[model samples]
Target: MDPIQGKAAGTAPVPLSVLDLVTVGEGRTATQAIRTGVEIAKLAERRGFHRYWVAEHHSMPGVASSSPAVLLAHLAAHTDRIRLGSGGVMLPNHAPLVIAEQFGTLEAMAPGRVDLGLGRAPGTDGATAAALRRSDRLHEGADEFPQQLAELIRFLDDSFPDGHRYARIHAVPGPVQGPAGRPPVWLLGSSGFSARLAGTLGLPFAFAHHFSAQNTIPALDLYRESFRPSAVLDAPYALIGVAALAADDEKEAHRQILSGALSMVRLRTGRPGLVPTPEEAAAHEFTAVERDFVDGWLSNIIAGTADEVRSGLDDLQKRTGADELMITANAHGGEARLRSYELIADAYGLPG
Candidate 1:
């Protein structure tokens, strides 16, 4: 892949990527969700998407990607070129050394086609997070994310300091040489804290605009302003993940987005479950409060015809100066979701 170049006035098409939550839709099983995810990854690679990433979410009936490393390995086996990674893996749920080994093993398998995008969030509710961490205290590891990130990097690079306690503990299948060296590490954030940390550490940054659109520009600005040259990156590089749903027509796109909108409503109300079908979303009645919440949530989503969505994304890139755009789409069914990506890819003219 070529280094990302700035687009003047955002007229030039930027690299596009996919961030899959592996959502298990209404009446669908986790098995079916995984199958759809793998199929989408294969299609995404063939359609010229730069990367196909899976997100981590624990104990969520709607989301099947509880273990990004495991899903990434499966994706790596099915796809050839598109980079496979965690859109991100929530680092607070596991130990740094464990994540290093998991990703190190993935790098050994896929060689140059692996990335490690790390997040500080627990990726689950308090109960589930505690279960995953095997600790009673929730968020105990979150505060140590920066230290853990640095340690994980050292493990991947096999560059632990000589006198460090973990210096002698080498991660098997450690850093490779040439183009397939240790997988690139990216810090994922929805706030300025992580943005500044990524900058200070000189790592690539990916902001979650899909869920936190209001903070996208601020986080990106902080990342760029605080960046310092390091061995991994000489200049600041950032990607913004957005929620997008494209269809042949604007009405169809809006209808498809209703399912996700309904799902968000349920999630925010502490009743999260499988993503409902369009029919269910259509029949469901919403109170004024729920309507307002859903409306505000939907405001961040780009839903329209191919051309319309493409225009919105272009404007977003211009405003954020994002090096790449990672899109996540959820629809009533697998085919509609796939079509959304197809339409966006066609509009962007991505080469296979």
Candidate 2:
């Protein structure tokens, strides 16, 4: 298949909606992290971002966003435009009906702006997963995601389940009148298998490029090459999540990214820290191999000045043919993080 291209212009345009203020913060409150996220979303909208999404993670002290739906609803209530949704909600962790109800209600409250990005992984350790399950529903947690997905879709669609017991059931804000009966849905994955499944099922795809750098390209390729248009999407629509950190200079940007980097390092090494202040990160001794991995990870990351970021984003879009770009900025403090996104918006000609 030929490569997909972005809209070219004589001048640079802020490519896609800017996503901001994600934290994994050093010594910060969950409330503080969430408020910071909301502030970034508001700024992005003012700057002309297209959407704002929150992620879900469980049992991580460094990361506060455990319930994406709850936070998304908070963001939806605050913003008038800019679509609000989950970067992804891990499907394996919750019942399909419950997720449908949560996001379905969100769609009802905010009418035309809700996106449900679903992931199949269990976002936490085995013990947490066990704690989240009900005893009677013990067997229900098995890998029935495909079936669960179908059930969620049916629940969201007022016309689904024709003549069945659930047919009479109504998903309140039932039949949200829009381009489609329900809000748009995208499958989130970091591997080729998911890309193929998403393609076969006829849904848009969003790759977790922020974490799974190795699988990013192959998965996208499979999705695009195998894509067959469905009722909801006429062609393949791809979105990639990239860790974006920007500062006045490359040196400073690199420093800012260390907090998020250390957070990941802790996860990998079983010694997580509060999003480290740059000083703390730079002071820590990293093994030669650890430093090499960090170097590779940083190479995959997009950080530097605005012009640098624009050029990188252009190349990334060209390489992946992604329809949308979700920029996850895990800069240390609230102010700096917001500034990074502001720079991106300014450089790319995104509104703000």
Candidate 3:
């Protein structure tokens, strides 16, 4: 029997994957959090998880995955099998050429194991967005996403039309020009805009269901409705990123998830800071409004014992019809976060 993933493990309901935030806990340093992310990726690969992705968020003390490309390079060195991707990279904050070259380098390192998931949002607030992107393009960021996306694809494939200014430019260390050579591009979205665009382009789409639960179905519907068969895909392929945490003890799982809830509360209230400990979250004072907000957020997260978490994930899959379920478990400590995946993997009977 395999030590990490048992050979007798039961079949899973659907493909299960992971999205690592590289979260910095209240008492942990960023360096430690990053190392923990490496461990998580290695574990995911050993346990037969489909993919391990890192998110990109800046100006937030809790999230340490600020530079996904840099971090993905590190993860690529540590894990051999599991697919490594940005859960995703916010395109507006970067130039098309820069992303193409960066991801192109990643593809060279990991070959077909690399995936480039792109998002249109700046991935941070207005001030940080201004600092990351050009001042002239600030106002037109969202409006310019389609054009920027087109340019990015062109750079990745060296398909820029003749006479174009960038036609002569090429993404160096470029992977082969075929489907398996380059990193597969997946459009990430929390709304219908990217859904429609991704479907129209016949690319895979991943929704931020962990944050935008209400829009999940609508956006997915829009994606399927607008889908047009292209070389990349002949049918709609959708993945949902969900917030879930499974543990040996239900109480412990709830406590860990509460820490994440507190962090989200701080982010929503414009006081973003490191993720608090369970004790700190337990001691937090909440007004009626804040209490309501916490309750609503908690409702979306599937946190409990392994069996309970399995049931919740199964139910969510039935409702969403997601081709893949990418879970993002946010706990105060790295061990707790890693353990959550282990418990969930056992519950789902994932095999190596």
Candidate 2 per-residue lDDT, tens place, 1-352, comes to 1112133222443236544435747767778977888888899778766677777877777777788877887888789877787768887778777887788778787877788888877676666766766344434554677777887888777656467877776666556344333567778888886688789888888898888988888999999888888887778878889888778898989888876776677777866556877888899898887787688777778999988887888888778777778888876688778888888878876644
List ranges where model 2 is wrong by over 4 Å. Answer: 1-15, 19-21, 134-142, 159-165, 176-181
- Give the least accurate 10-residue stretch of model 1, judged by summed lDDT: 2-11
lDDT of 3 by residue, 72-182 (tens): 999999988788899899988889889999999998899778889999888888888988875846768888989999999998898878899987888876634445477
lDDT of 1 by residue, 1-352 (tens): 4322222222336778889999999998999989999888988888878788889988778889998999998988998878888879998887888988899889888988888999998887888888888997765587788888888888887888779888888787775343346788899999998999999988899999999999999999999999998877889999989999999999888888989999988887789999999889989899999899889988999999999999999899889999888989977578888899888877877654
Checking candidate 2 for backbone clashes, the offending pairs are 14-348, 24-62, 26-275, 47-351, 47-352
Quote each prediction's TM-score: 0.95, 0.90, 0.95
Q: Per lDDT, what order, best first?
A: 3, 1, 2
For model 1, the stretches where C-alpha displacement exceeds 4 angstroms are 2-12, 176-180
Decreasing TM-score order of the candidates = 3, 1, 2
Cα displacement (angstroms), candidate 2, residue 87, comes to 1.2
Error of 1 at 47 (Å): 1.3
Total colliding residue pairs, candidate 3: 0
**Range of the 10 consecutive residues with the lowest summed lDDT in candidate 2:** 1-10
